[model samples]
Target: MKKRFWIAIPIMAFGLGWPLLAQENPTEPQPQHAQAQAQPAVSAPDVKSPGTPQLDAADLEAWLDGYMSGALEQGDVAGAVVSVVKDGRPLFAKGYGYRDVASKLPMDAAQTLVRIGSTSKLFTWTAVMQLVEQGKLDLDADVNTYLDFTIPERDGGPVTMNDLMTHRGGFEEGLKEILITDPAKFITTEKYLKDHMRPRIFPVGKVPAYSNYGTALAGYIVERLSGEPFDDYIERHILGPLHMERSTFRQPLPEKFQDNVSLGYMSASQPPQAFEMITSAPAGSMSATADDMANFMIAHLQQGRFGDARILKAETARLMYQPSAPHEPGFTTMAHGFFSGPINGKRLIGHGGDTIWFHTDMNLIPEEGVGFFVSFNSRGKNEAVYGMRERFVEGFMDRYFPDKGNEPLPPAIQSAQADAQALAGKYRSSRRIDTAFLKLIYTLQQSTVIANEDGTISFASEPGTKYRETAPGMWRDPNSEGALHVSTVDGQLTITNSKNPVSDMQRVPLAESAGLNSFILFGSIAVILLALVAWPLSWWCRRLYGQTLGLTGRDLVAYRLSRLLMVGDMIYLLGWYMALQPLFQMQFDGFGTALDPLLFTLQAGALVPLIGVGVGLWNAWLTVRSDRHVMAKAGSVLFAAALCGVAWVAFIGGLMSFTLEY
Candidate 1:
């Protein structure tokens, strides 16, 4: 639910036939607080340079109105909240549309609590840093030392708290109990992490693979050291100090704030979904009013002080600001917990949060003492919130802290076609399962880089954006000024760009390219189905025409055996598809324990191709060597080859995996 960029498909475009939710004064925003009036700019110690526009509440609110009005109407989103803080003062806060569509309850910037997803991690990180400020936690020590449960060490070393902070713990993606409406599936962070511990696919402190379990592990550590629940520890140390009164990490929403929580929707045109329960609560489970979020953001912007309260010390906050992994001039890096980057000529630290329905983004400019937070209660048609958040934040930056122009291209741009060509290929995200059936899903979502007819290249992820080589291996997008840094690592090209370093893209070999995999998948299915229909139809046609019995012999036996193999292989493929169809629909119910029997059946059925393909090869040999008709020989060879492809695909795709870890 982090809205990982690896997925090219829409996030929550749940298909429904219901009419759009009705609203009174649909175009006009209903606010708990009226539109802010023009007021003098809040006193900031940092003065603006010449020609900088004054950021006042009236101007900010008016600008937000022009944007959100059309955005909600066009995108079919129900409601949203936006808050901006300048220096140590809140500059603007407003809500747009309805919080409860059925009751026509308007969204309230001060009262409507919206689930802020992974933004919850920022609070968790603050809690951990506070403990580190005391002597309760060690940032560099093995995390296993802090836990009652053991997390086995991966290659190089045991996962340290720093590794979890930087998201370099190398844990494979955890999908079970991620988002569930079933309260029965709801489990604590400790229970989920302990029961469903993931294997480390990458070495410890190496490769950026986003892991919710890692964050949960960190949260659990805080839970153990503080002698309290994760949620309570967060509220007492971080939220309480920051005075984020409306916020709570509690799953069901504390009883008092329950009525104020906004209903999340796949789309405003569709019915509302039940409250999303995140088992990995530490990673992404917190709801708060936009105004409360502003307070939290103000603390970070002012070096962890909010009025009389302090959540993180100045030194400790600065430590969080330090990049855990810095790249070349215009590439990506991760701070201790924040995503630190060079954006619009300013150093920015921020994090994006996403749930199944709600989408949220938070950003803070330490140098400017400016913080911005926005949340959408609906994913909208085609998950429009994802692009909306990025464009909104960047638009704000361009409007206020305007960049002077694009960065000057390096000398390498003069003749960097060769390097650009070298970078053009299929790339897969490193946050992938190494050995599980889930890898098949990752394969389909792999990214591609194509060398344009011109000297520029483009990433499939950022369509329409062309990047020219600004440095030897750095391709800079002129539009966004984001650069992608590609280099060979361990004999394969791994790319780290201006995007967050939660994951990097690695070059995919041609044999394992998604294109090839898709080709084999569809082509084999087509061939198998064609063979299946023809075998039955051809025999019926021969009998209808009163033809001979095809001269019964080993040739007949081979033909019959081939049909049997097709039947078994086809059944195997379809069975797996039936089991996995839910995932294709972007639902995770099929991954729960309830589907274990179906999964086991599919895994056991993998033996179909394992044995059938061998028998198919023998049948092909028997038919071909028997001086059969030219058509018969060709059909036998093609049939055998098609089944062989299916078998190979099954093997490499991990359909043969007997475990349900994926």
Candidate 2:
């Protein structure tokens, strides 16, 4: 669901007999000349003839080989395997580079077992669709009926299967909060639903927020209805039927196939870490070879038939290719699993996958009966894979609709220095109240630019430690993309694209500011301490102050602590607000700045009662403390809570040092 640059053939053109249109003439094309330009028209060639105008076999091989080699040269990949199939026949299948760089082992086509990432979701969806075809599940039925746990509804209506498939289930983005931390714990669809039964972020069946949890839930539904494990069901129903013997939910690299496996490598900044299998297998924990993937693509292109065997009915496959939801403009359609889009007017369905150490792409042109799969074992920002797909599609289109040759490159337009400077002014979005600073930062340590770019930028922080820009105005320190934005306005810098106008961009001297450090250190320590102590204090407060507080000591403690914590949180929030305020008129409220330490301390204090209640309750249950020994119980709780809070705060503070701005 994370949007990436996509390259696929058109579905409408490929399906239902839509005539292919030639690429727009480059000499007289559209106004936008930011990136790629359109190609010129070519005459169509006869498809029935065996010999036609297409990339020569030798040239095609060289192109693919050059692509793989270039990827390695650019340090975007350590090794890779590529496979091209046309008309259900293997045009070429080969591997390039080393599988084990340290051991100096060569990679082979048959042995690669790379983490295919979210592409695994396609297989999961395929299995679910197969079940749908079997009359085992209904897309419109309430998913909660099959779930073992309650799925909280939005507006008192349970989410349906269709919502899950289309990612319109109204579930919050649960990956960072739930999945990444401990996926297995939330494995059961029922448990996941129960834990996340809050109101929808957007109306169901409206906006689509890509959710791995939603797809994982669908996988679970398959398991429950099929009476088989999610992985086994796919293997038996889909993979097995397609004769994809090497593909598996588990690591596909066995000893026999180890020789051919490509060694996945991260950039030197992000050295290869030991691979840990994700417990959320359905979302992105599977491995397969180019040979196996080619077969799968071929089956889809052939209307769900592999040779004489029909893996899925043609009508069902057609439904899978139908547009299920509206995507951002330029995107063809987001079908059940595949993305339906255009490539020179030819319909194409495909998906791309990016994991820790791999990038993959698969595209199929059903009308031309051609498909290709390419995977890289390293990660970088070069758009070669996408470019390769475009070229391949161009070749295909030229063969089928020869009149549509490669589009001419757009005329280069150099922005005048004065104009460029004029456009350099700080600009901010009018949608939000946050401001992201985008300027060059010169510190005693190093000089760096925070300039906002259209695409990703990487920072080499330390050896094997890299930061990648995951979103506009935001960079991911290590792996996952964090939500952050930056904008420019009249040469002034603002952080988030807040609606509020920012003052002037005043440079802050980078030094050890006590207030900033305290906010960083104490704010974190207090939050952790409070979080640790709040619950326990709630219980003890229920017993001690419950009668006096007009509620259980626990309830009173929870309520009071929550309120105070909320206040402290508000102070910090206000400080951030002031920091983003317009410079000229900005006034850091004395009260807000002054209360920083107090708020921190109060946050720590609130934890005391909470911890006291926890220890008291635990000790009382275990008979470790007598009723007369309330003070001792409270002390014990305080000690334990303080230790946990300190430890947690330390960890969080370390993380903040790399991520947060003072």
Candidate 3:
């Protein structure tokens, strides 16, 4: 019974948790596989070099208007605030469309408060660095040293502050209670951290999975060390010093600031939605204007000083922008908190954020003394916000830093047949769940890397796109200059896009891929539903014709049990699916209580279908031995196999677990 329970739990859990199970195993031994490329260097742009610029103010504005205005009109986004700072001064800052469409209130770049999502991590990282500068914290020291609670150490080692900053802490992703709708549900940082500490999955300092829990932990540590609340610490040291008077981390907008807060919308045409409350406040709960964000950007671009106020020494500011961990050899790595990537030959550091309704991006070209910030008030479909950001940044760089004929690309390798074939497999993103139903979503999003006949690799997720060998282990898109580096990390083949290392995906074992499993799962469900309808309809027709089911021994029992198991499994699947609908609806206040019974029912009910595996075989064997119709024998055998596949797939997907730990 205990074994049966263990098996039953994950069948449903895997339905959602398969992708999470594919997350990197931190404790797994790292093999000494020789990598193909030298470590990529961080190119420090000439800070004082007047970079070549072919665009005047008019050209820049015209290009931006064309892109932003059209995107706002097409996407579900209602309004946006854009700001560009060059040489520590605003080159352009303005609002597009209306913040409150019903009231027809136009956005004010400097006054409208918009939730900046994970870009709030910049403030948290900035606080940690400030503490480091003041000798209150150590970057390499065990983070547990400053925390009231211990972050369980894995084989890699105790996670240091630097690991948290670089998102290498190896903490499993937690989403169940991360985003809540009610303000009352928002607990203090101390309580929230203690209650929601996630499992440490990967070995410390190895996997580059972005961890909101790790960042929030950093914030809690700041709260402990500074002897101030996390919200107060930022206000006193960072926001106050920079005079970002309108910016805040507080939920439930303060009385004076309420009128200025923009209504968050799900779509440009839909009615406004409730303001979001992220339980991990430090990781993402920031509300600030474009003008306020510009000040924060200027402080970093100027090496920690905004006008007369300084947040950090010039050296500390530089350290904050430096890469923290290099996951792939010769690939741009994650900086302290910012993601390091290249845009048109320039090395830049930045962060992007999104809540349910708002999308925000803040980027800085440290060498050019330039920064860009943009925020949208509505949660748009089609990813228009992200598309706009990518285009704007690339356009800005192309116009300002016109590429003069530069270094020649490494000669294209004529042969990479073996390597490309070896790389052809399914890869899962590290930023996924290992314990929750949300893993199902990630599983569907897994990318298939296919080795083409032309000695190039294509990704199923990005159709009509192929990456060809430019150098050993390096592949470049023929249509675009973007590149990808393929190498073995932690004994697994990994790929990192030139755009963002944080979005890298690692290859997984063949058995772990969900393609075959998902196909079987859906196929078996369809077979069962068909059998249910056919068996009854055939029985009714036979009764009318005065015919009957022959066989009154184990064959009859086997047939009855087979149908029962199929129906039982269907109920389990449909039950869990219905229970999960509210989870996706953003109404999560009573999720745990609501999910408990469904989990319990599924756990016990899963064993009912396990019996079908055997009964199905018995029925198939009997039909094959008897003078039954060929279709009947074949259907019996196929149905049994489908039953076994469904259960096995469920188990592998992490749906078999009995616990509510997720």
Best model per lDDT: 1
Candidate 3, residues 414-436, lDDT tens digits: the string is 67777789899889876667765
Report, for all candidates in order, the number of backbone clashes.
0, 56, 21
lDDT of 1 at 635: 88
The regions of model 1 sitting more than 4 angstroms off are: 1-52, 411-415, 461-463, 548-554
Off by over 4 Å in 3: 1-61, 327-330, 405-408, 478-481, 582-593, 625-627
Stretches of candidate 2 off by over 4 Å are 1-57, 176-199, 251-261, 268-271, 327-330, 380-662
Quick one: best TM-score, which candidate?
Answer: 1
Residue 178 accuracy (lDDT) in model 2: 25
* Order of models, best TM-score first: 1, 3, 2
Error of 2 at 145 (Å): 2.1
Q: What is the TM-score (0 to 1) of candidate 3? A: 0.88
Candidate achieving higher lDDT, 1 or 2:
1
Candidate 1 lDDT, 576-620, residue by residue in tens:
888777677656544677777888888888878877687778778
